[model samples]
Target chain A: MSTSERLIESTRELLWERGYVGTSPKAILERAGAGQGSMYHHFRGKPDLALAAIRRTADEMWATAEAVLDGPGTPYERITAYLRREREALRGCPVGRLTMDPDVIADDALRAPVDETLDRLREHIAQIVEEGKEQGEFAPGLDGEEIAAAVVATVQGGYVLARAAGSPTAFDAAVRGLLALLAPPTR
Target chain B: MSTSERLIESTRELLWERGYVGTSPKAILERAGAGQGSMYHHFRGKPDLALAAIRRTADEMWATAEAVLDGPGTPYERITAYLRREREALRGCPVGRLTMDPDVIADDALRAPVDETLDRLREHIAQIVEEGKEQGEFAPGLDGEEIAAAVVATVQGGYVLARAAGSPTAFDAAVRGLLALLAPPTR
Candidate 1:
């Protein structure tokens, strides 16, 4: 990869592991195996480089979600698939985790991609839910947007539980509970 | 408050705001208005003092949740009251946020209270859900444990969404969605 590409990739990993406040420019350069001059030549500064990394992370998250949401099977199946997809639970959601970083939330530019990524995820899920409601697969009174928000929250919150307990069972239990609720009404 | 009490309170605030890696011993001392000798005299070091703060936060969280959960109301009402309680969304959960801090998660002693607190919360909610199920309030097929996990995840995850969007609406949407799912069957 080019120096710029390497730098951006390294920044993404650091930001995921260390958060914005913990990650330093020096660490980024070292991890990328690039010099100070190379880093500056490629980007204005830490925030600029972080923005690039965050945008890339956001795009990747969207692409991954789209693959499942827009893929084969019914809307319910797609959502189930999305929920069951492989995740590094202990590591937490790459984009979702950034929300906890004060530095990221304090800056609009820094937070935009993160915000947009989650919003899109919720909206995408809402659209699928809408389809389900229209097809009579879900209760007519159900609100697509609301269920979508719950779905997103379950995944994000699962990470928090998993990390706290040092066990993925906490995460699995949450998903299972949500799926049970979403199961087609038997009554 | 005593020097130790002041120190612990300051540490809690710092941990909530800056996380484990970001909070420093000197900063803690400064915030508490305690001198170096006083801080050292009160605790072994940062981690030790941090444990006290984390425990306090956990206890306080339980106390607050218990008040709502143990209050006079239906199981659903109690759960709803717990959900609708006022929170500082931007600041995030005092205990839940620690899971993202590598320093805290890496230290078993530091992570214990956070893990136990959440686990206890899930169990507490599960018991309430079980009561609801037994009383024909919730669907008989519902797993109290699973629903409890979802409830906890929603709150923890709500902080994530709210922070991501820089608005509390995202959090409110998730809660509303989950509540709708838990609503008594009309059919």
Candidate 2:
């Protein structure tokens, strides 16, 4: 990969592991095996680099989510598939973890990608649920937006519980519980 | 406040906002209104003081949760109360945030209170769900443990969503959605 690619990749990993405040330019250089001058030549600074990395993470997150949400299945089946999708529970979530970082959330430029990703994902899920209701797969009165939020919460919060216990068991349980509650299979 | 009390309180605040690696002895001392030597006099070091602060946070968390879980009400009501309980959503969950801190999760000493609190809380919620089942308030087939995990995840993940959007609206919606699904008002 080019110096630019390596830098962005390193920033993503550091940002995930250390967060915005804890990550440093020197650490990024060392991790990416690029010199200080190379960093400046490629990007303005750490914040610029972090934004690039975060966007990449966001793009990747949305890609995976859309694949499932927009996949072939009823709203209930697709939603369940999305939740049960294998995740790195111990690592928490790339986008969700950023919300915990004060530095990331404090800056609008840095936060835009993060916010957009979550907003879009939730909206996409909501649209799917609405489609389900139209198709008579879900109750007519079910609130699509509210259900969307619950589905997103289960996955994000499940990581927290799983990490605390040093296992993915809690995360899996949360998904199962939510699945049982979601319009269960009537087939 | 006593120097020890002041130090513990300051550590708690810093931990909530800054996390373990971001927190420093100097910051803790400055926030607590104590001198450097005073901090050393009260605790062995930053790690020791952090453990104390974490335990205190966990203690307070349990105190609030139990007040409702053990209060005079049905299981569904108590569970709903716990989810709908007012929170500093933008600031995020104090204990849950720690799980995202690499330094805290890396150390068993620092992680104990966090892990214990979440474990006990899930178990407590699970026990309440079991009661709901026995009381004929919920379907007997519901998995108490899974439901408890979902409840905890909704709160933790809800905070993530709220912070991401810079609004508590997402968090509130998630709770409302979960409530509508959980043992509906069938009197």
Candidate 3:
């Protein structure tokens, strides 16, 4: 659409594929079908555009997780749905991948959205877990925050494993294993 | 160290920090305290040297995991020790980080060690899980392979979370959560 929108969109895709260090302003302009003048006219520089892109990606990630977590279902069902939801396993999580970028982590401004997104996801999962406990669906003594952190870690780690293996089996297997572990104990 | 040995060591460190695309021939030579001729004298080029580094990193990763998985105490204890082991959380896993490198994943030759290392780890963990099942330390019906994959994912994912937050709390919490899920239900 607009030059600004195109620049932000292009920055998001490039950042996902190449990371901050690997990405260059020239490449972003080329990808966006915009020129140097358009880029500067639209934003101050790469960092400014990148911050917008990171925030957009973070917001998108939260929205996707929020839909599943807040969707109508039992707490366990919702958690399972979120895990089983389709993903481009090899590409990895857009937000999660940013964590590996040295340039992104070194800058507080760029890193804030990344940290906030993960923290919010953990909290969202913890809320669902607490609801499960209240409904007598989960062990009352279980700590929701801890379990939520584990859920997030498993998903992130699953991406790393799947990418490492060049297949999605490890990813699927990890999800299956986590679900099993979270299954209610049979008396 | 010999020229070849120094070259390989330097390549390993560079690969860990900057990834495949970001690492350069000149950079590797400089880091190794070797000359350009010395690099070519030892290896064919960057790819050749990288393979050595990848294999070395993979072997080192396995050795570290094996020590814990094969060490003292029961299956549960071993698993817990491995999860709780000290790590440079922000730096990420040496071998695991390679998975994020587009170049490494694109080359079959480069990807072999990464795949093998992860596969062997899953199998190693699966073996322990199976033993735990047989010993009646875990639920009999749990799939050892699935649980093993989940355990591996948690560690990989833990790194992602910790790096995102610039703290180890999420990583530690994730471990605590998984262990809680894995704990045998008390009647």
Candidate 4:
């Protein structure tokens, strides 16, 4: 990979591990095997480089979600696919994890991509719910936007529980419970 | 307050604002208005002081949750009261926030209090759900542990969404969405 590509990838990994505040330009350069001059030549500074990294990560996350949400299947099947998609549960969501960093959240440029990624994902999920409603797959009174919000929260929160317990059991339990709630009630 | 007490309080505030990795001993001492000699005399170092601060915060969080969970009311009422309780939504959950701090999670001493706090809180909520089930407030097939996990995740994840959006509206939406799901469905 080119120096710029390597730098951005290193920054993304560092951001996930050390967060924006804790990650230093020196560390990123070292991780990327690039010198100070090379880093500065490629980007304005740490913040500038971080913005690039954040946006890249955000796009990747959205693309992954889109694959599941826009997959060829019924709304229930697609939503379930999204929920059951393989994930590094303990590592947590890259975009969701960035929200915990005060430095990242404080910067409008850094925060925008993160916000848009989630907003778009939630909208996509809401649209699917809307589709489900149209097909009579859900109760007519169910609010698509509200259910979408809950779906996103459940996934994000599941990571918190999983990380805390040092096990994914809690995460699985939470997802199972949510799925049970979403299942069609038997007569 | 005594120097030790002041130091712990300052550490707590810094931890909440910047996290364990981002917070430094100098920052803690400065915030406490204590000198280097006094800080070192009171504690071994930042880790020692941080452990005390984390434990203190954990206790405070548990006490606050218990106040809402064990209050006089039906299970739903108590849970709703806890959810509706005023919070600095954008600032995030103090204990839950620690999970995102690599330094905090890497240290066994630092991580224990954070882990235990969340565990106890989930257990506390699960017990409430169990009671609600017995009282016929929740569906008979609902898993108390699972529902409890979902409730906790919603709050933690809600902070992520709120901070990303730079608005409390996302947080409110997440909470309302979860509460709607928890509401009993009429046949």
Candidate 5:
């Protein structure tokens, strides 16, 4: 890859590891194997480079979620697909992880992509819930938006539980618990 | 407070603000107004200090949640009270925040309080849900554990949304949406 591409990729990895507050431009340059001039040549500074990385990570997260949500299935099936999709449970969500970084939250340019990604995902899930309700897969009075928000929260919070224990068991349990709630009453 | 007490309190604040990976020993000492020797005298190092702070934060969080959860009210009323309790929406949960730090996850001692705090909180919530079911406030088939997990996830994810947007509106919306889901249906 070119120096610019490598710089963005390295920033993404470093941001995942150290977060925006902990990561330095020097570290990014070192990780990418580029010098100061080369880094500055391609991007304005750390914030500029970070913004690029954040956007890339945001897009990647959405694409992954879409693969499950938009895949061929019934609404319940799609929701299950999204939850059961293979993930590096210990590593946590890249976009959700940024929400914890003070530096990332303090910057509008950096935080926008993170906010938009989650908002879109929640909206997409809400749409699926609405479909489920129409298809009689869920209780007639169930609130689609509320259920969608709850669903997304489960995934995000499940990561926190898993990471804290240094085990994926909590994450799996949280997911299984959610699926149990979503299952039809007769089953 | 004693020098050791002051140091632990300072570490808790800094850890909440910057997380375990982002905080430095120098920063902790400086914030506590304790010199290096004094800090070392109280604790072996940053990890030891962090464990104390995390435990303190966990205790404080549980105390706060119990105020709402253990209050005298209907099951739904108590759960709603817990959800509506005042919080610094942008700052996030102090215990939950640590789960995002790479260093905290890397060390078992540092992570124990966070894991146990969440685990206990989930159980506490599940117990409340179970009571609600027994009281005939919820559908008989509702899975108390699953609903409890979903409720906790909403709070954690709500903080992420609020912080990312630099507004509490999203957090409020998420909570409101979740409460709507938990509300009884008019048959």
Candidate 6:
């Protein structure tokens, strides 16, 4: 890979592991095995590099979700697939983790992709939920937007529980509970 | 407050705002308005001081939740109360945010209260769910532990959404969605 590509990938890893405030340009250089001149030559500074990394992470997350959400299945079934998809629960969500960094959240430019990624994902889930509601899959009173919000929150919160307990059991249990709630009323 | 109290309080605030890795010894001392000698005089170092602060935060979070869970209300009512409680949603949960801090979670001593706080809260909520189940408030098939886990994850994850959007709309919507799911089976 080129020097710029190496720098972006290294920044993504550091940002995921240490957060924006904790990640330094020197560490990025060391991890990327690229010199300072290379980083500045390709990108303006740390913030500029970080934005690219974050957008890349956000885009990849969307692609992963899209593959499941838009793939073959009923709306509810697809949501289940999204939840049950294999993940490193302990490692946490790459894009979601960035939301916790004050430095990232405080800057509009840094935060845009992170915000848009979540908003778009939730909206996509909401659209599927709307389809389910129209098809009488979920109960009538449930709001598509609200239900989708819960679905997204469960995934994000599950990571927090998994990390705190050093296990995926809590995350699994939470997802199980959510799927149970979303079960078709024919039961 | 004593010098130790000031230091602990300052550390708690710093941990909440900046996270463990971002919080420095100098910043903690400055925030506490205490001298370097005062910090060393009371605790071994940053880790020791952070533990005390974390425990304190954990205890307070428990106390707040217990007030509603243990209050005079039906099980479902109590859960709703817990969900609807006033909060600075965009600032995020103090203990929950710490779980995202690698420096904190990696250190068993530092992570104990954070893990315990979430575990204990979920367990406590699970007990309430059990009571509601026994009272015939919820559906017969639901599991208390799993349901409680979802409830807890909603709050933790809600903060992520709120922070990402720089608004409380998503968090409020998430809690509202959860309450709808948890509504008594009579509906």
lDDT of 4 by residue, B1-187 (tens): 9999999999999999888888989998889999999989999998999899999999999999999899988888899988889999988888988888888778888889988888898899989998988998888898888888888888888888888898888888878877877876642
In CAPRI terms, model 4 is classed as medium
Cα lDDT tens digits for candidate 1, B53-142: 999999999999988899988888899999889988778999999999988999999999999999999999999999999888899999
Can you tell me which runs of candidate 6 are displaced by over 4 Å?
none
Candidate order, DockQ descending: 2, 1, 6, 3, 4, 5
Clashing pairs in 1: none
Runs with alpha carbons beyond 4 Å of true place in candidate 2 = A185-187, B185-187
lDDT of 6 by residue, B109-178 (tens): 8899999989999999988988988899877788989999999999999999999999999999999988
What residue pairs clash in candidate 2, if any at all? none
Worst 10 residues of 2 chain B by lDDT: B178-187
lDDT tens string, model 6, A41-128?
9999999999999999999999999999998888899999999999899989999988889889889999999999999999999999
Off by over 4 Å in 1: none
Off by over 4 Å in 3: none
List per-prediction Cα lDDT, in the order shown: 0.92, 0.91, 0.90, 0.87, 0.85, 0.92
TM-score of each: 0.97, 0.98, 0.96, 0.96, 0.89, 0.98
Clashing pairs in 4: none
Candidate 2 scores a C-alpha RMSD against the true structure in Å of 1.1
**Winning model by DockQ:** 2
What is residue A114's positional error in candidate 5, in angstroms?
0.6
- Here the TM-score of candidate 1's chain B is 0.97
**How does the DockQ of candidate 5 come out?**
0.54
Estimate the lDDT of model 6.
0.92
Query: Could you give candidate 4's per-residue lDDT for residues A20-117 as a string of tens digits?
Result: 98899999999999999999999999999999999999999999999888998888778888988988888888899989888888788999999999
Supply the TM-score for candidate 5: 0.89
**Clashes within 3 Å, all models in order:** 0, 0, 1, 0, 0, 0
**Candidate 5's fnat?**
0.54
